[model samples]
Target: DAGITQSPRHKVTETGTPVTLRCHQTENHRYMYWYRQDPGHGLRLIHYSYGVKDTDKGEVSDGYSVSRSKTEDFLLTLESATSSQTSVYFCAISEGLAGGTQYFGPGTRLLVL
Candidate 1:
């Protein structure tokens, strides 16, 4: 992807603890998203924002929240990190592509202890 950065490339947290991951983009795209990748789940959207302060929940949004107050930044927060949430977190952006093609960031690996 032309514009994407995920912070805390790797993390290990305890269960019931809170965690927040940052996603930064330089493309100034209007659509930003957060997804988690696992062996079986593949890539599942947590949330997405179409514009500043305009966001919506996705299929796997439970326990997660997102914020996009600027064109170049989007954030994902996990209220309480659980073992089940241990996966690679990725940030994505749609450069207004049709057919729902999205560009993804490297990813952040989170482990719940």
Candidate 2:
């Protein structure tokens, strides 16, 4: 697991509720990414953090937000859960933005009804 962690690996919730997913890494890598996997979408980046307190939005960042207060932790939150948000989310870590292999943690499966 490379010291990477995700909380509540499986969750089921109502559409209007708020949901938060967490990703923690002990590797202390420079780049951490959040991605969602769905049937047709394959894998889409949701958000990413390059350093403590430095984060950026990704293609599917419409209803999501992320925070990184330390080198080892990254947090993702959904303001309002929706059925369309149901998917497997993965957290990845990399040493560099380009050319480095990104190691992924076991995904968190979320179902919004």
Clash tally for model 2: 0
lDDT of 1 at 27: 88
Best by TM-score: 2
Give the total clashing residue pairs for model 1. 0
- How many clashes in each structure? 0, 0
- Of candidate 2, the 10-residue stretch with the lowest lDDT total is 94-103
Clashing pairs in 2: none
Can you give the TM-score per candidate against the true fold?
A: 0.93, 0.95
Q: Please, what are the lDDT tens digits per residue for candidate 1 over residues 23-79?
A: 998888888889899997789888988889999999899999988878888989989
Overall local distance difference test of candidate 1: 0.89
Superposing all C-alpha atoms, what RMSD in Å does each candidate have to the true structure?
A: 1.4, 1.1
